[model samples]
Target: MMDYQLNTPLNGNLAMTSCFHENKALQQDTTLYKFIWVRSGILTVEIDHIPMRLEQDEIACLTPLHHIEIKEVEGEYLTFLFNSNFYCIFGHDDEVSCNGFLFHGSSQVMRLKLSPEQSTNLNDIVRIFRQESTVRDNLQEEMLRIILKRFIITCTRIAREKCGVTPEQEKAFDIVRRFYILVDQNFREKKQVRDYADLLFRSPKTLSNLFFSCGVPSPLRIIHERVEAEAKRLLLYTPKSAKEISELLGFEDLSTFSRFFKKMTGESVSDFRKSNTTGSIAN
Candidate 1:
């Protein structure tokens, strides 16, 4: 079961905390970026609506300020919050953290199961994060950036090993990651895969191969997934009726949009919204 306990914000910005035992996740509606590191036990992580199961030493990042919720959060977890202004301290002027809850910038979000050595190193950062009050200095920013970057590097290496991709394949995967970022950003504006491939200066076939190599679906499939995500968001967040949303999403007719939504998400837009209001996962 999923439950939520909202946390009070610190400053005019975000807040970081240490989790004890959580019965419910927190519902944060902030545009500022948020992060979490699993200190112990397991966490079911969802960022911008994408879900993953993360164990100890695994970290999650979120941006785009979409719905990021954690389920099955037992034992210890450390939460961190950041945004453009905050991350600028790290000298990352345009660095994007994946929707603030996901680690999908290829190397940035490698799944790391902390070995003993790595765990010891990460503890230093966790220790700092857990302290409710600390000295905020130049060193503090450097420490957080180093800790966060190293964590992602480690996780990406682990993810590569698990996926059986070599160094060359890994490079391709980075390009694929960039494609996704672009597609995600422009999904509502640019619907077709070619539009993305053209912008990326690659053929659709090359884009398809890149995704296929990364263990995801084809480029077109990813585009559809992007479109479908917007449809679901419209369904859940807006009080606007389905027909209006369908038209707004660029569908010619209500029937066409309804059919497309059903084909992609396996339910009518109205029913999808209805069912999600009822339960976690439904048929």
Candidate 2:
């Protein structure tokens, strides 16, 4: 297990490791975005209470809002972690163009499976990352950011392909990605497709058409799912009562929240929490 880290005075931090357990503190940092690449073997993890398995040559892109628990690893893996201070995806979206597609696009974790050729290319970028990690210079941060951008660009390319997005559809895909970002930022306050459509300066019908053309989930469904995911995370991980969570999530009242939860998840809030707690204890 080898680890290399670069830390800056301005709260910028980046780390690369072959073993997931090498840096427990960084993994627990909610402000960090993580790219977990299963170089070889299988890696099982629970993300936002849902268990998922990643096979060799697969990568999972995780945002700070995700709750992840590494369950098992049967072989070698690589992880690259960076905080927003290191490189703000949102701020630098124009440069890397991975702000929403790779990080905050969906309620579920974004997993990309790599071809052998793609795997080799990513390995080359990672090798450069390793070499740069040992060098300290005035331009070190900039150099690393450049390499990181390349890595993200590569993944975003693969993601576009995986989603069946063609070069011609890039503009439409950008709209969908922007919608996801807006939902991530405002789902707590704005829960309707029309709300985001207004922000994006598109009609609700246009947004739906764009999403349908991209073969992605509907805008309204995305908004609802994002809200449900956050509610589940709060219920399972925090001691906040349902009422408090309802208010925190901008629900008009507890009953409204309860009804929303039931419609989204097919269970009452208390039932969901109680069952999850019991399942944890049983495990």
Each model's lDDT: 0.59, 0.88
TM-score of each: 0.72, 0.95
Candidate 1, position 37, lDDT = 70
Q: What is the lDDT of candidate 1?
A: 0.59
Query: Residue by residue across 53-142, what tens digits does model 1's lDDT show?
Result: 888877655543355656567767776654444343224413422221143222123344656666676676556544423545556554
Please, what are the lDDT tens digits per residue for candidate 2 over residues 39-76? 99999988887889999999999998887788898999
RMSD of 2: 2.2
- Model 2 pairs whose backbones collide: none
Please give the range of 10 consecutive residues that has the lowest summed lDDT in model 2: 274-283
Best by TM-score: 2
